[model samples]
Every structure is written in structure tokens, then in C-alpha cells.
Target: MDDMKKLLEEIEKLKKEIEELKGEKEKKEFMESEKIIEVIDKIEEIVKKGFSVIEGAVIGSLEGIKRSLQEKENGR
Candidate 1:
């Protein structure tokens, strides 16, 4: 569970990084965007595997997992 928590945090960080990249105006910086895309894919793979390990049920998208996390946070 702790590992999954870290993976969730990484996903959030990746989201912020992608947003930040979008705000950049330099064309040179845009070239680095592909690297971030690769990172996002890798993190997503890890998250999917983590979810499979943590939950035996049908774990769909990251959005669904996020909602589950949010529900847990709200004491559902």
C-alpha cells in the first residue's frame, strides 16, 4: 500500500510536470516533452501493476484508482 501511495504521488508529479511543460514557450524545451511522455508511460505501467497487486478486482483506468484513493481519503 505504501508503494502504491508513492506511485500515486509520482502520477500527480508527472501531471504537474506535463502542465509545466505546456506553459513553456521555447521550442527547444518542447523537444524534451517526449522524454516526459516516456516517463509517464513507465509510471502508468507501474501503477497498473501496483493496482493489480493491491486490488484483486477489476482495476480499470488510473482515474478509477484515483477515485478509490479519494474515497479512502474522505473516509468512505
Candidate 2:
């Protein structure tokens, strides 16, 4: 009966340790996920700004070319 009691105590201690480790793992995973989401949001913002700049440049270039062509035709 003494031996059985000792074994039960050991098992309970192990179960508590396992629970603590599981909680730590969950916290770590949540932090990593939050970091990933932050990075993704930043990347999306940068991409949107880059695309807007590119579109503006293209439109300005096209307008300049059209104006030049018109001036040349008028001269001819």
C-alpha cells in the first residue's frame, strides 16, 4: 500500500509538469503567429505603395510621349 501511494504521487507530479509545458508551448505559438501577421501587414502596405508609384510613373510617361508626338505633327 505504501508503494502504490508513492507511485500515484509521482504520476501526479508528472501530469502537472506536462500541463505546464503545454501552456508554454501554446503561448509561444501565439506570439509567433502575431509576429507573422504583423510582417504580412507591413509587406502588403509596401506593395500597395510601390504599385501606386509605378502606375503614376507610367501615366506620366505616356502623357509626355503623346504631347511630344502632337508637337512634332504640328510642326510638320
List, residue by residue over 1-76, the lDDT tens digit for candidate 2.
Answer: 9999999999999999999999999999999999999999999999999999999999999999999999999999
TM accuracy, model 2: 0.81
Clashing pairs in 1: none
- The numbered model that scores best in lDDT is 2
- Single out the weakest 10-residue window by summed lDDT for candidate 1: 54-63
Q: Model 1: per-residue lDDT, tens digit, 7-68?
A: 99999999999988777755657768978999999999999998888675555466688998
In candidate 2 the C-alpha lDDT for residue 51 amounts to 97
Give lDDT per model, in order. Answer: 0.85, 1.00
TM-score of 1: 0.36
Clashing pairs in 2: none
